[model samples]
Target chain A: MTQVSDAPAKTRAQISQKTLRTDRWWEQPAIVATLLTIWVTYATVHVFIGKWYWVPQYHYLTPFYSPCVSGECVPGAASLGTWFGHLPPIIPYAVVSLPFVLGFRLSCYYYRRAYYRAFWRAPAACAVREPHQKYTGETRFPLIMQNLHRYFFYMVILISILNTYDVIQAFHGKTGGIGFGLGTLIMLVNVVLLWCYSLSCHSCRHITGGRLKHFSKHPVRYWIWNRISWLNARHMQLAWTTLGTLMLTDLYIWLVAAHVFSDFRFYN
Target chain B: MSYKAALRVWRGDHGRGDLADYAVEVNEGEVVLDVLHRLQATQAGDLAIRWNCKAGKCGSCSMEINGRPRLACMTRMSTFTEDEVLTITPLRTFPVIRDLVTDVSFNYAKARQIPSFTPDPSVGLGEFRMQQADVERSQEFRKCIECYLCQNTCHVIRDHAENENAFAGPRFLMRVAELEMHPADTADRRDIAQDDFGLGFCNITKCCTEVCPEHIKITDNALIPLKERVAGRRYDPLVWLGSKIARRPRSTGTPKVPDNRH
Candidate 1:
């Protein structure tokens, strides 16, 4: 604490601040790093092992493979037509859109801070200094790409819309009738959380509703802005939730597609 | 009825210091500041502490009780068990002047760096029309009492002394946000925010929001929106080119003050 004595009175000496925190400061960042690493590992493995990311019977597509661009999609699974004729074997169909999705998260304000603090330990917690002599911020080359978050925000909206379509398609089972299943619910929850994350984005909030002159003139926009404001308040929570559910949605389809365990179908 | 509590308050100057223990009697409704006042009245007449309203409103009594930044007048005596040693210390992020007092002129210096609201003259002659809806969020940000609690809690400059030159902590950031979001304010500050104010330094850990006594959503509402403005206008390749084209000598009548937005 800063203490400059006033007058001729007894006062102890002052200490320069190194780390003023007393609680378990490192524990939170360590745990966040662990959780993020697990998610990243799972995502990387699944993105590469891409075969089991689809369940043709349920029209269920894991987020990693949504807008499944490769012709290798299981018969009838490439609901969106293959852009290039089916890929040569070995390459995953999901590779096409995954970059944009990953970019969305990488450029996310919350995740940017999370990884910067947790992984890089740049002032990891309140009142704890990093070893670095300088902070370049997101100003240079690759880090500068973080400013593309607004564009990434736009792309995620498009990807989320595609995911929404896949989820809608999931409602129709193999028999071409409305169906509900563990996988359908999984895709549903995944899309919902994805929307929450995207809509809660600071960029999304700003574009859709912020920086306004008269919200009164734009009543509908203002209303949506307020609801989004509610979501943005918990943006960090939704960001983490989307990651967990995104992993679960992919895992459920992976298991069901691999026939490791059949999807528990409720209706078809 | 009164309860006995042991208080370990930091006592020192810039040269050296340690925790000095004081046993004080506290009433049920009293707060940490009341205990300090009691300590002043009874045992330690020479002890120094900063305070104003004695209520939580003025924000004059901001100090860390235990490890968290808070208003000493707001934290209740009952919140702690009688045995817990109440560690009262000055705000850790600043340099101390005496016990429980740190020189917060750093914030004032940062405040002077900001340009005040400059409205577009074309809008009106005297009156301006702002929809309540448009002004709502700015109103929330205006609730800030300048307690600097959020500044004290913010990590951007708290521990990283090197960042002090570039980064303006949560309080001034909120000020910028309030003005930027103002309905009539038309001066473009996006580039200034990014390049000068170091808006990119904040990672939005929410510690500032957690410590705010006024419940301002410093991270989500102000800082993040300000960031979007920075990202939207300042870094866009097209806007970058456009601004380069529009760049001219700064005699647009807007007083060529030495771009103190830093």
Candidate 2:
């Protein structure tokens, strides 16, 4: 490296302080840590609770238990068929899909930034010094697994299709007519947000139009790419929004299933 | 509307420093730079500062105002309340030369590391014709004033001095993105971006984007797209399989321009 004339003769200033920033730099990371911890704790407990995940009357199944593939599931809840027989309490009923969902969020570009800053304290905010001395980032071993985000993207697409199917089945009424209710509306909103989040993924954008030499040649792909690009700009917002929607959808179903409150029927 | 604004400016050389307090005159239309200039003129003539184009365009007067990276020329004094002590400090990411000036050669070094745009051999000068859409794709990045605010704000090199040798911060990474997106450029920058430039170190925190004065979506338009382009070559299994089947060399020196380009 060529040393320029104005290069600093000394190393970084030997100030014995971690940072000179006086702003509330820690607030953002603290909020992120608190929210993520709460979400993870809730998700873990609900995934294992296994009961009150289905309401047979309204066909309202919490996303946490969708495609509930166990013989223990309520008869109508096992829409995808019970591939797994009665298992021990340790495993989740949606075990097949849960890992892929977890992997999708774990490897998402936006979520990666959130967790890395919040949980890992990788310079929690800009200019803040982190505790760790050596930073290899995603170059080696466990972190290199982040490159599998594209694969997780693919898996999440398949799971989204299944989630869409669950939404379709959710149209059932108590009287067996086409149903529309508060549960249906909540599930509909959740599924729509899920699609928005998935479609706006960086991997999806790449698959749609990336690597193409000329946009003129692929008009169809170009159109889709442009739309995805718009959504891609809001990927961070969509990521957090979907998490909230997913929890809300699951919680609504859990409450209905547990008979905490009856589903508010808009029509039957 | 004129009053004495309490200003705290970091003072000292590369060896050591501490914040020095001053009461500088401030007028309604004046900026932080104006106040600093007044301080320099009246109180301390020896105070060191670097500035060019008192307008925000030159990007030479980058400093931290109350722990935020900003161009002193752009920050109005009216934004601060009367009681608030306006603390101006040099950028934390780089070595300070004196008060409010740091050796930004770190950015220049990173800029030198990136290979410049290598146009396709087939496309002669003046023969290059680009669609408007294609031109606009990279034009957003061209607005960068090289303030190095993005560099100073990026946590990769800011906190971890060890990673300085590898990571090329957001500004130069955006430069690579610009070249990579250029329809005529032929040289493959994906490998160099991931391997040599330490693009992986950027976890898309968006701090660079947040600090950008140009409002360039550095994380969205440049970095993420560049990362996707790299992934297409390195990680996509289908692309890997197709490349193996076709027996095509990865870094062939030809641009991927479609034959339709006139």
Candidate 3:
């Protein structure tokens, strides 16, 4: 009979240095942190400001206040009738859909990597040590809620439908005829990018073709899954691009509503 | 067209280490491993490095060249500027065994944890059949060379040592993904993939894919599909209710009779 013994576990190299990577490993996480902070701050302030979110002339409603359900919403802005009475200023105008939108992005597979690296530093980058001694990842209570991404995805689709409706409504001319302006173009672009981001989602790809044991039996689903997989390959890029477009659309609407400048009207 | 290339190779063991610089001859069309081989032959013959086949296919000479995880056998010397100094280091994710060689037993341990392909016992060997599309779905992952580059580059285990116990890194998870997608594999791997193998830990950063010499879309094709499958089993309420109503018991050890109709 051969005898076997357990060997002592080997420890990592104790070089004292944090990381031996000579390259600028901090650059990516730093840039992500800066951009996400600016966007989140701008969004939080704007969501609470509750003013200059709607341009009544051209039916241009900022995404920040779309489906404006509160009584506090300005006249003509609450296209989807005000469902709630006047409330505290802390609450956003599109309170009904905002949480789901936030949840959708927050639980996104791509965004999860972004914030996990930038905010949590569960690892800032590959080969770089994170600050935390222990990492539970999304296996625990709060992080485990990330699994609810599919549920959040469903809600965001409904909100996006409302956003599409808002864009369609934004085609109003000053005299009630068809209107086409820079705001219309911006909102249109924003909604298109929004759809791209939503459709390219990992959850969307899975829901489309994941559980199917055979691809040949379900040709239509297989085709759709292939398209979604192509889009899903660029989910990270779409995730960031939509963020930029969302902010750009809102900023344009805000500026127009505040009379910062008139909408660049091509036809009215 | 040979030139004198300056090389900085990390020299040390598990306890401590530092970069030792040397000037070596680099011939045209040569690779980083070639220069290292010459260096090992002429000077510093005692220097330790792991390599075999000297070809990229073997996935043996994996190291960080200029801070990127790559197969040294595949990296050409001409990619860098003439004046640039080539810095070679061992994979950061594993404990160093010697100079440029890391103890990759972690991957072996992870590989051991995964249950082998559990084809239905009723289906005789060599009698199993599968659709070409289904075969192609997992063929991408079959190209893995066990380089451990993906395992080394994956941030879940690369940075977080504690995560080693939970996360199996991209390579093994890709293995699980491949087996799970196999038409004949009757093992119910969704729960183990989530609970044991740590599929939830992967954030789909594509680092594994980027480092893969095989270019096996480890993130997009394998990990994400596995995640969706796991989500179908665990998260989707309708799927859960359907399974329960259908009285389909979650099988663990026993392989289910293969359903050829799929």
In the order shown, the candidates' Cα RMSDs to the true structure are: 4.6, 4.3, 4.3
Q: Tell me the native contact fraction for each prediction.
A: 0.37, 0.43, 0.41
Docking class of 2: acceptable
lDDT of 1 by residue, A17-64 (tens): 455455788998999999999999988788767588777788888888
Provide the overall lDDT of each model, using Cα atoms, as 2-decimal numbers.
0.78, 0.84, 0.83
Q: What fraction of the native interface does candidate 3 get right in terms of contacts?
A: 0.41
Q: Candidate 2, B70: how far from true, in Å? A: 1.2
A70-181: candidate 2 lDDT, tens digit per residue:
8798889998889888989998998889998999999998999899989898868876677887787888778877877888899899989989988888898999979879
TM-score of 3: 0.92
Clashing pairs in 3: none
TM-score per prediction, in order, is: 0.88, 0.94, 0.92
Q: What tens digits encode model 3's per-residue C-alpha lDDT throughout A1-268?
A: 1111111224454444556566788999899999999999999989999899988889999998888999988879998899999989888989999999999999898888788888887667766667876666667788777788889989989999999999999999988989989999999999999999999988888888866667777889989988998998889899999999999999999999999999999889
CA displacement after TM-score superposition, residue A117 of candidate 1 (Å):
3.4
